[model samples]
Target: MDMSIVLQAGVATGTALLFATLGELLAERSGIMNLGVEGMMLLGAMAAYWVSAHYGVPWMGVIIGMLAAGLISQIHAFITINLRADQVVSGLSLNFLAAGVSVVLGEGLNSIKGVAILPSFTIPLLSQIPWIGKIFFTNQGILVYIGYLVFPLVWYFINRTRQGLHLRAVGEFPAAADSLGINVYRMRYLYVFIGGLFAGLAGAAISLSISPGWFSEKTTSGEGWIAVGLVIFAQWNPIRAAFGAYIFGALRRLVLDIQGPMMILGLANPFYYNPYFGFFLQMLPYAFTIIVLVLGSREAIKKRIGTPAALGIPYIRGERGM
Candidate 1:
């Protein structure tokens, strides 16, 4: 396979992961762990595709899709934040709920044809900068470019601003933040909502930009889960998250491309002849995801690392300490 082609495709596919990872990262930063990212993505993809198919307006479809996912996220927020439910259980339940809703509502989406897709374009000066340009700046969807801007902006927002400091304070010490009158409950709800919006955007990116369709459960596949894993591997750092996302994206592209009937370096391609081997290859990314999630979870507990101290815990208004 052409390496540049693989990298180019990786960037495109990885954009969806970038969005999802950032969303989950933000929620986690605000002391909430949302495991319903996959469900939210699926719902967003279905809504975006369904809308675009009917109205011929991909942009509006994106808006409606994001809103749908964001609204559903409030369910998890209400249960975990308001009722003080187990965050993990609540998040997982939200996933099932959103997935069921998406499947039911998306019943006829895949059958629609001639839907309008989001636009793609090559940057003139930027697309000429050697390998980097070809992989990132050439004929990419508008959302891909947006991901590039969002990465640094999010990093800045998390680490370099007054609001970011408040976010960190609430996540690290909700009681302390509340003492300072920062409105801990309000902050968590807002970030969780923001997380859902990002997840929805990821879904819209897939149906309207990246893959350009609604494929039921297969639409998002398991990218949402992968994004969660990425956040763990990233240790709650946006820079690390972006790096991991792009690398995983490339690996995903490599898995599919290697199955083609072409020589590998100078030898024959085993996966080309033995198509069944593609299944194992396809599992590599997810296997890596599981490994990362398990190991990262252990490391976070042992080392504190970049983890928010209050993550996954419910905050009572008068509790003075964690």
Candidate 2:
């Protein structure tokens, strides 16, 4: 396979996963575990494809998809954050709800096997650079640019801003933030909703940019799950999350780009007839997560690379719990 094709595939995969991971990172940083990322992404992909197919403007599709996902995720956030419902159950329920709704809606809209896909758009001048230009700039959709732009902004927002500090405080210790006069409920809801929006946009980017005009039950596959794993792997850092996404993205693209090696290794063409290989490839990011966590769980590693102090813990006001 041509190196350019591989590079483009990596870029596309990274872009899609980048959105999902970034969103999840934000949500997690707010002390919310959103296992419903899959659902959000599916809804986003389906909604974006439908809108773009109908409106002839792919970006509009992405916006609509993100909004749809965000709206659905907000329901999850409300139940869990405001009502203090079980976060895991609520998230799982949202995932199922999203999948069912997207499938049914997609069938209704298309009345056929699949939805329409989007086309690529390359910018002038920037797209015309040498080999490096094609890898980073040329012949891609607008979503790619959006992903690149979001990285630095998200990094700055999380590390350098007061709002970001407040968010971190809320995640690390809600009671502390509460005592400090921060509205923990509001911040949690905001991050959760934003995470959903990003996941939705990521899903839309998959339909419009990566796969570009493909819509089926298997459209998102397990990319959302990988995004969730990427959150932990990135340690809630946007730039690191981007790198993690790229690693998984490259692996995913490799499955498509390289086909002959399996046969040479006495393995059948599992890509056909067996969809699990794709899932396994997608699982690599999660596997990496496990390795990192295990290694980092050691005292030596903990001293160097610790988890967020209050990950997965619920915060109650006036509680002395650490």
TM-score top scorer: 1
Clashes of 2: 1
- Residue 5 error, candidate 1, Å: 0.4
Can you write out model 2's per-residue Cα lDDT over 58-104, one digit (the tens) per residue?
77898899999999999888888767778888889999999989988
Error of 1 at 64 (Å): 0.9
Estimate, for each residue in 1-322, the C-alpha lDDT of model 1 and write its tens digit: 7899999999999999999999999999999999999999999999999999999999999999999999999999999999999999999999999999999999988888899999999999999999999999999999999999999999999999999999999999888888888999999999999999999999999999999988899999999999998998999999889998888888899999988756898998999989999999999999989887888788888986877999999999876665
lDDT of 1 at 58: 97
- Cα error, candidate 1, residue 154 (Å): 0.4
- The Cα RMSD in angstroms, rounded to one decimal, for candidate 1 relative to the true structure is 1.3
* Model 1 segments more than 4 A misplaced: 294-303
Clashing pairs in 2: 117-213
What clash count goes with each model? 0, 1
Name the lDDT of candidate 1. Answer: 0.93
Candidate 2: residue 248 Cα off by (Å): 1.4
- Score each candidate by Cα lDDT: 0.93, 0.80
TM-score of 1: 0.97
Among all windows of ten consecutive residues in candidate 2, which has the lowest summed lDDT?
109-118
